[model samples]
Target: MADYTTAARPYAKAVFELAQETSQFDSWSGRLQFWAALVSHPDMSERLAAPGLTHQDRATMIEKVVGDEMDEHSRNFIRLLSENNRLPLLPDIAAIYEELRAEAEGEIEATVTSAFELTDSQRDSIIGALSRRLERNVRIVNVVDKDLIGGAIIRAGDLVIDGSLRGRVENMERAVVN
Candidate 1:
């Protein structure tokens, strides 16, 4: 799995550079998102992987669906992927490209899980605190898990701040046993 991600890095970088060079990054982003969704569809994935389907036919289907929505560069990129039998890898590529884009913009994704849904003000406060701690713009994705009982957990990249009631209880148990 790591090997696959390593192999995909070059392709993802090349596409991102191409988009940046042509000033089509946003357009490509939108189009690739569309293509990624289409490619992931059960019907389309089956069609794309069928041994009987020719590369040209796959390209044709892609063009038919997104031709009007995408720029020429993106369409050509898709054609190249189809021609090289790499359509199935578009999702990973798109994800990597988005990661690069976000990093470039000094933004990081943080997942916040709490016992209840956070109010807008609470969410904003959390984002502010995380931004100060991370020294980067924080994008919060909030989730509610009643099992958490109280407080919230924050995960950003390799850092996880477990402030939930469950974590505190576990820590207390460990201390008593020690």
Candidate 2:
């Protein structure tokens, strides 16, 4: 797939700045997510790609569907995207906007993949450790993967801690081979 993230960055940053200036982070976040989902729908995607619809028609259709949910500024933003043929980039923009929002709020989301489900105490412990280490509010997303055999692999931003039993065995195997 084409990398839309690079093209979406400027738009995401612009929206993030606007949200910050207006203290509307949550509102914009929700709007972007909604728009992304709307545009990503198979029917909507097909309609958008259809040659019969002019940019104005596409924008109008979206506006009608959104109705009063969009404020003047949001409506203008949507129009700008339509004019630039960037409506398809909403998912990337929303994702990047969320990253900016999380950074601004001093929060980070972590994914923990393990062989078994984590107990409440274990989850709490992982959250506490990650919060302390990262010096930011940490949100944990737990995923169970039987392939891990045991233990867990924690990922937060660029940092990864691979403590899975499968990982250890692989390391040992590699060491013995080399």
TM-score for all models, in order of appearance: 0.87, 0.96
Candidate 1, 57-172: lDDT as tens digits? 89888888775765666667877888887887787788888888777778999999999999999989999998999889999999999999999999987889999999999999
Clashes of 2: 0
Error of 2 at 107 (Å): 0.4
Best by lDDT: 2
**Which residue segments of model 1 deviate by more than 4 Å?**
1-4, 68-70
**CA lDDT, every prediction?**
0.84, 0.95
Candidate No. with top TM-score? 2
85 Cα displacement, candidate 1 (Å): 2.6
Task: For candidate 2, write residues 63-174 as lDDT tens digits.
Answer: 9989988899898999999999999999999999999999999999999999999999999999999999999999999999999999999999999999999999999999
- For model 2, give the 10-residue run with minimal summed lDDT: 1-10
Runs of candidate 2 exceeding 4 Å displacement = none
Candidate 1, clashing residue pairs? none
